[model samples]
Target: MSFRLNPFKVMRAVGIVAIVVYGVVLVTGYKKSKVTTTESVTKDMKIRNKDFYKSKDYKNNLTLPNQVVENNNEAVAKELEQTKPAETVDLQKDSDTSKQQTDSKVADKNKKKEEQVKLEMQKQAQQKLAEQKQQEKSKIAAKQAELKKQQQLEAARKEQAAAQARAEAARQQAREEENKKAREEAAKRARENAKKHQGSKKYIQVASVTTEASARGIAKKLGGNFYYKKTTVNGKTAYVVMSNMTDNPNTLKAMENQAKRAGSGYMIRSVGK
Candidate 1:
């Protein structure tokens, strides 16, 4: 049997191998970078040490002459002192310059602190001003609100007063109209009384009862004075119950209503001699 390659399987295997190779390359590169970083650090340390030593050696070389001259016998001391005084002066000048620079830096720091304090004060002042303005605004708003409330109250009071005045005027006018009507009614009553005196006034005969007691009882129940007259009715003597009222229509009508409450039969008639 011959072994046949599946193209898909072959491609899958190739891809897996390629992936493995890429991962290995990435790992190797990372390790190499770590190693290179370490070597570079070591080289930098060595170079720094070498440079430090060289600087120290240079300083020592420069100081050798001074050391030698100081170590020499007293015969050269005076000569060295005269020769090195200028250099000592220069060193002193350099120290003085350094001290001045330090003092200048301290003064600059103090000036900066003062400026910060001034700025803070300005901010505080601004904040205070803002608060004052806000207070003023609040006061103004309160005053305005109070003024508006007062105005509204005044307006309401005025409206109420006007309404009351109008109601009073209406009541006065109604009273005047009622007075006029009463006066006219009094005059009319006077005229009617005059007319009644000229002739016999009308009266209502409420009932005809055989007994005076019955007549009196009905008149008492009817709440009015009554009189009786003997009349012949059906050839028999009968006592008629009559109300004492005038011919005025209102009086007759009132008596008629009262007689209805007393009994059913009633008649209107004029007074006789």
Candidate 2:
């Protein structure tokens, strides 16, 4: 094959194709960028998947609601129990001892039942005794009340008797006062009758003459109606008084003695009327 070279036309065709492709690519990219708006966004603006959020959440899903923690002593005890030897129970060796224990338990229950019965009986006896005591007290109170009523009735009777005696004494005293008043009225009437007696009377009196004033004093010592008459023995006035005078000289002497005893100290004289 002989070479006949034509390079210009091939090169021009390649440049034109390249320019068209570049324009198409630029347009497509600009439209894509305008619709998406995510090329300049960061992780804070990015919408994350719900699956990724679930993986990153810190909440516990497997923990118990009321879990308990064993302390030091409890933990030790649990460890010892888990490591300790287990005891095996005997099936046939302790039969006689079990029977004896059962018998003793039955005996204790029976004894307690008997003691309860005895205590109940004692309580009943005490209650019966208390009831008897209350009855006896009621009887005694009844007797005391009856005795008091009797004593009150006796005292009332005695008071009635004493009041009657006092009334009788008052009646007797009023009767005695009535008799004494009647006797006094009778004696006053007799004395009035004696004072009104009138009959012809004689009088004799005696007097001393040492001083005229003394003889006139004796005459004036009598205190009844005085009669006056004038007679001149030596032209002097003589005054006299008349009273009840006795008719005998012996009675006149007695009257003179009585006048001498008087505190006026003038003796009686003879002035006949």
Candidate 3:
């Protein structure tokens, strides 16, 4: 099969290659520029040294004093005297210019150093201020957290106390209701007893018989506070077995129930005290 190239893939590959080539060109150009600058500085230094060696000042220094005397001593002496002051003045001017340039450079350096020191101090002060602010923020955050925790604890305590109070109130209400019910039951019982013992005397008649001996025997068999009594029933004399009298209807009811369990008949009777 013939190889087929995708246009998009070809474009992507071309773009990548172009980028790599551009980066390489940029790096090469920077290196070349650095090398050219170094070469130019060296060439300039060589030219200056060559020119200095060729200058009149260098040639004059090389000439011997015997050669100046041989040429014309008096004329050379006069010319030297004439040029001496001018040379001295030129040297002074050069020295002063050099001093001024040095002083100017020193002042610039001092100014730059002062500016640097001021900037450093400002940076330190700003950093200290920032740190102080950060510390204060941390303290405030910690205080807020502690306050929130305390508030939550207080709320929890209050809620617990309220719950306990509610429970106690409910228990108190329950106790009050129980006491009220007990008192009402006792009053109802008292009322029933009052109704039952309306007359001067009330007794439970357990049994009636013709003879006292029979009545006494039944009272003994019945047990529990039973006695015998003589009574007229149907206009005839009869002996009756009796339970003890009580003003409490509850007690009378208990006696009746007991008698019933023993399979005996009973009647309530009022008699003279």
Candidate 4:
């Protein structure tokens, strides 16, 4: 496995090393400055003491040794006091400089940290926005797909309904055709039977009336294979409603029963008779 260096960790280590190096340099310079100041002060004092010892004032002071000694002691004391104050000012300035440098470094470090935090927050916000947009796009796509699916299903249903309608219409037309053909065949058979029995068969009469209109009305009410005929009844000119002509006794009997069910009375008679 390869070692992957984290940038943040590397940067933090570098800052720590820089701080340690700066601290060491500041401490070493401060110590060297303090030593140099002490040495310079001691050399100046030694030169002044040597000049005082070699001067004419020294020879005069020999006559008043005690007063001269006291004056020299006071002068030395004043020099030491003045030198101590200057050294203290230098030390205080060094300390203040060191403190300022430390404060500046701390401020820079804090500013960098804040910037990193802000950058991280901005990145997170952008990522969240992208995720939301993706979700919205997904929703829209899904909705479109669902809509398309529903439209297809609806179209299929409509097509199915249309197909059923067409099939039903075709079946209804076929039924109508069959019914028409059956009616035509029935009419043809009735015409042929009427021709075959003409002038040589008998008919069942269901109604005898004084008016042709009444006889026709009775025949219409009697429905199939019935007609009206002009005749005489009770010595008055009248009309009669009759069943279809037939000579078979069984057919005549069945027609007689049918006429009896349709009217109040019925009679069977030969066409010419």
Top-lDDT structure, candidate number? 4
Per-residue CA lDDT of model 3 for 98-186, tens digit only, reads 55655565557556655766676677777788989999999999999999999999999999999999999999999999999999999
Which tens-of-lDDT digit does each residue in 69-174 have in candidate 2?
Answer: 2354476577666663433333233334444554455456556655665666676667777878988999999999999999999999999988988888888888
In the range 119-162, model 1's lDDT, one tens digit per residue, is 76677777788989999999999999999999999999999999
How many clashes does each candidate structure show, in the order listed?
0, 7, 0, 0
TM-score of each model, paired residue for residue:
0.37, 0.33, 0.35, 0.45
Ranking by lDDT: 4, 3, 1, 2
Report the lDDT of model 4 for residue 102: 70
lDDT comparing candidate 3 with the true structure: 0.71
Candidate 3 weakest lDDT stretch, 10 residues: 84-93
Q: What local lDDT score does residue 258 receive in model 2, on the 0 to 100 scale?
A: 56
Q: Rate the local accuracy (lDDT) of all candidates.
A: 0.68, 0.54, 0.71, 0.76
Q: List ranges where model 3 is wrong by over 4 Å.
A: 1-96, 182-273
Candidate 2: how large is its RMSD?
Answer: 43.1
The most accurate candidate by TM-score is: 4
lDDT minimum window of 10 residues, candidate 1: 84-93
Task: Give per-residue lDDT, candidate 2, residue 203.
Answer: 52
Predicted structure 2, TM vs. truth: 0.33
